[model samples]
Target: MQDSAAGAATMKALRRRRGLSLAGTARALTNVAAELRLPALPAVASVQRSVARWEAARPTRPDDRYQLLLGHLYARTPAGSIAIGPGSDFAELLTALHLLGEGERRTAELRTAVLRAATDQGAGMLSLLSPALQAQLAAALADPARTTDETVAGLAAAVADVNGQVGTLPMVRLQLLLAPAVDAARRLLAAPVPSAPLQESLREAAVAAYTVAARLAFETRDDEASRAAYTAATREAAQLGRPWRQAGVHMSHALTTMYATHDLAAARVLADRAVRAAQRGESILVRARAHALQAEMLARAGQARQVDTALRLAWYDMEANHAGDPAVTSFSAGHLRGFEGVCELHVGDPATAHDRFAHSAAALAAPRELVQRAIVTVDQALARIRMGAPQDAVELLHQSVDAAAATGGRVPALRLRDARQALRPWRQETWVMDLDDHLLDGLGA
Candidate 1:
């Protein structure tokens, strides 16, 4: 293995046998890190370079973490392992070796058990008359130990970090982060824990993970997965008995219903539920978010009076709430303004919508909010189109499309498509045709 050519050939062969591209292998390593609760996961680029180094046999042996991941990836068991060592923790080594040995069967059984536990809330009695059968049952029912408060808090922070990165990262990369987090959260929920506080914290973390998953799914134009994730979040939030969590879940569901399904009535209902849930909580941030969602739904429904009332309520709540916990609710003046701008557009106030969008875009200066700013810019462009400024709309639309394409945001891509259709009256105009051509070139349409 120390021979450069032989090591390079072996590494390349292993990767090929797994049928994974360099990027795919990097993503798989990320997922393995998340699932195993590793302290650190390498960046995709780092993993890509490492693969290249291995294929080149540059006298580099990856650290323990990468070695374990590689072993797992290649299905190396205890008998066939190349990485397990005396310094490795015995329990972890055994677990990894066992999983590698029975990967498919164990994965299927664990998935089935998790689903059953989630659906039933209790497992059925198993026949354990024999010692061998008892051992098998014990192994099947084993769960990870309860995590510490600090660990739980760290997991929550990790989810928030991913949420903040959504605007900056490409959709595929975000999904890679989110999928494993969601899976780990669900697995934690299925495991038995001793403390109520631990359970509550886990539920909260799970709710956040599920909400982020739902948001990502919505952005990627996966309506069914979005709804399912929202439903799962709602369920987890309900288990925690936290009105703020419930309100957040409902608000997320309302957004999906409004944007993805175009079910305005259902959106309104969900928004109302969110508002009611928030009213039962002390978190003014949650209450304000609920009101803002209500405003958007009402605006879409053409209820101008109700929309204004909802916005006013949200404003009042925000004024009263001087502080907020992002882990619980991420409502801010800028976010409210963006929502208001969207509502204003729907309520036939293109000028106000444009102004609001401009303000919101200026306020949203965070690097992670780039995609969001681009989205608002696109909406502002739509307002311009409504105000009979097709040329300005075309320019803004081009900027928005470029920004969205950079991040692979499906929602903005869809909006750009709609904007193109809206320019049908001026389709034959030179600028309009040029915009269309640019769009086609960018989108490979």
Candidate 2:
């Protein structure tokens, strides 16, 4: 009973970290009861009150069975037939895993059963489980061979089931649940990582989480949070022990420095770190991304030859490695391409800049990403304006602003501000004046 009570307390803590409401927790419990074919009416109410009491300034008896259920619920995997009454030992095991970041030996035994259940009736698990479990399952399914299209389909079905059962949860919990997806994605890109269709789905989930957190940070101008999340994501990528992923983290950090803050020297240092890490891994894709970012930062510092050298490396690395289209970058490679093109123009190569911007914009077109799309769009518009296409530039800038507004992103808005400042002298020659006025009116910068 004491062990279960302790587990119950941990469960409550996880819920609090996730920021779930009592009603939301109750709904999740109700869904769990229904899935288990247990009595829902009073049991769910009991769980709800117990959870509330745990949250309050009082003490409640820790129910072992309840804590076990909560672990299974948060785990998103099948609890199997483990005896889970008030004195069960599973609660202690789970508590240890949560606090120590290491699951017990029994956790591995449960893995097979969990995988079987995730493969078979994963839909039920999804329906009865919380966001945290769903995220873990997404990570587990990231192997390509094991997680084929069928596997991804199963996982998606499970996610949908859980979505239907629990509806929307607190944003923070949802974010935490998605963290594993990001971890899984790094695995997919790593050298020893497995290739699974479920990996693609997991990648999509990770991207979703990044987009949300990045957008929130950009909107609130929370540079600290933005730096922290991006850095943490990079750390996760590096932990996967893949050169490309490590480089990708470096590139991401570089971009965060470039656009999120005004630290060019720090940005260059990060870019250097990315280049070195990618080189160490012998990952052509990673090297190319790092070089390209380096070029952008160098251009900012008025180093023309360095820009040329960086782009040269980018092109050469992609060609040598037979890498796939330079897909990954610090700030969405496709959009950063436009900014790179603008760098060429700054160094007195309008034609080259024009071509680069066009290619970059085409690559970035209609992405599902709100934040990436907006950043790329803003760069694209600026590139066009520099290339003497004022009308197209104006329209593109407007679209960029709209996209940024949708995500509530002040960083992109600030980028737009920089573009406007550059075109200040020609404000009357195009629609730049009106758009600039609008931006200043709302953004106050």
Cα deviation at 379, candidate 1, in Å, is: 1.3
Q: In candidate 2, which residue pairs get closer than 3 Å at backbone N, Cα or C atoms, i.e. clash? A: 5-62, 143-196, 144-195, 144-196
Give the TM-score of each candidate: 0.66, 0.51
- Model 2 off-target regions past 4 Å? 1-220, 230-240, 321-339, 369-373, 383-392, 426-433, 436-445
Best by TM-score: 1
Candidate 1 residues lying further than 4 Å off, grouped into runs, are: 1-143, 324-329
True-vs-predicted CA distance for residue 13, candidate 2, Å: 40
Quote model 2's TM-score.
0.51
Per-residue accuracy of model 1 over 33-89 as CA lDDT, tens digit each: 776677666689888887676566353444446766664544322333222112222
N/CA/C clash count, model 2: 4
The lDDT values for all models are 0.70, 0.56
Which is the leading candidate under lDDT? 1
